[model samples]
Target: MDIFDIVGPIMVGPSSSHTAGAVRIGYIGGKLLGEPVKKAQILLYGSFLATGEGHGTKKAIVAGLLGMEPDDYRISDSFNIAKEKDMKIEFGEAKLNEGHPNSALLRLEGINGNKIEVLGQSIGGSRINIAQIDGIDTNFSGECPTLIVHNMDQPGHVSEVTSMLAHKSVNIATMQLYRSAKGGNAVMVVECDQQIPKEGIEWLKHVEGILKVTYFAGI
Candidate 1:
């Protein structure tokens, strides 16, 4: 029960869920990719697939991928902007097995060949839930600096990550862990109160058993 929940977000929108939230989803997707988006494959689901066009959902997503925010007045002109920047974008519908009505899956490729897949949902009032990253189940609001680590499900991995964060003095606001199975792939979604230093991220990349690390400096 906050002001944003009641009044919604200040955005260029015909619908908060479709427009504003779509922008955020794209924004987060871009951040997770870690570089300028060179190509984007956007798949809409449920309500977003049914009525998103009329609500400017497509343009909003493209705008966010171009590094625009929800309140950016240029959202409506995102398609042209993307073309000008040589960003290739494709849109389609997604078949998700039981999820929120306003959901989208984005497959993004960066200029440097970095790629990421993100499944995000707009619950309401411009708030979002990033449900999956690179096919791993995740749960984070993207409201804080988030650290997502993909690693082998083994002993000491969790403690290693936590210890590093503690050493950096970054407080964790919330953390969730998910795994495919015992001794299989695992992911840690850690939302922190402070921005993690670039050196810390680089250090974590070299840790053994760590497969991938994605950090989102909060919007």
Candidate 2:
């Protein structure tokens, strides 16, 4: 294991999993939304709800939705900042059928009327896993630039996306696919070796069978 794994991340926190990792989770959720966050509904599960207040879990999540990093001093004052920005924030408990204890569910509403749902779990040492997106089960650590594509389940969609990425010279390090049923809603989750150009993402958005394309250029 790496030395950082034993030591932990540099952050403003009483607990790495609860505070620092929670911030990252919220930040990633905001990125998925792709616009200014106007409303956030956070659901704490298990350990996160048990000891979140003392660890600043809620505040850290707010800080992230506002685009602050883990070590941002502003995390302490995130509630006030959110109020000033006219953001609607709420907190609650969650029950999941499966996942880590330090898990959270974030429901975000953007100013553009866009909505996103994300399930994030903090494994340990400030590392996190994004377990689900928009109800699709996924497993990605957000350690690299990643692309999440929501598309129709149809022939040629996968090849079309892979071909496009290959043409753009973007290498896919790993990829996963999920679907609701046969010939139904499907998601393509790709972890790339390089940052995908904005043009490539835009091009994917316009693809015939593609419904939505979300890109996260690492944390």
Candidate 3:
């Protein structure tokens, strides 16, 4: 096992799972949205909802959405900063069924009408798992540059995406496919060793059968 797994991340926190991990969750959510967040509806689940306020979970999440890192002292004042930036913020409980206790669901809207829903869980030692995006099940740690594609479940779309990445000299470290049902809504989650250019993303968007494309450089 990695040594850091025992030590945890460097963060301002009373608890690693509640504070630092929660920050990472919000941070990843912000990155997925790929724009300035204008509004956020954060849903806390299980243990998070029970004692998050006392543990600074709420502030950490807001701080993360504002692009602050876990160690950012500004985390304590994130709500004020969000207010100054005119970002609307709200918090509520999530009725998660068979979900991890240290999990959250983030619904975020950007200034330009972009919106994304992210479900993230803090497993332990400040490491987190992005469980879902826009209701599509996904499994990525946000440890590497990731490409998420929402598309129709049709033939050849998978090859098309992989081929595009290959043409750009991007090497896929890991790739996963999830679908709502056969020949229905689907998502392609790819973690890459190399950074993908903006042009590559645009190309993926215009590919026939592709619905939406989102990219996140590892946090």
Model 3 spans with C-alpha error above 4 angstroms: 4-8
lDDT of 1 by residue, 134-202 (tens): 888888889999999999999998898899999999998998999999999999999999999998999
Q: Write out the backbone clash pairs for model 1.
A: none
Candidate 3, residues 1-219: lDDT per residue as tens digits?
Answer: 878767656799788889999899999999999898999999999899998989999999999999998889899899999999999998999888989998899999999999999999989878899999999899999989999999999999999989989999999999999999999999999999999999999998998889999999898
lDDT of each prediction vs. the true structure?
A: 0.92, 0.91, 0.92
- Please tell me which model should have the higher lDDT, number 1 or number 2: 1
Q: Considering summed lDDT, which 10 consecutive residues are worst modelled in model 3?
A: 1-10
- Looking at model 2, residue 168 earns an lDDT score of 92
Candidate 1 local distance difference test against the native: 0.92
| Per-residue lDDT of candidate 2, residues 156-182 (tens digit) | 888988998999999999999999889
In terms of lDDT, which candidate is stronger, 2 or 3? 3
Clashes of each: 0, 0, 0
The runs of at least 3 residues in candidate 2 whose Cα sits more than 4 Å from the true structure, single-residue gaps closed, are 5-8
lDDT (Cα, 0-100) at 23 in candidate 3: 90
In candidate 2, where is summed lDDT lowest over 10 consecutive residues? 4-13
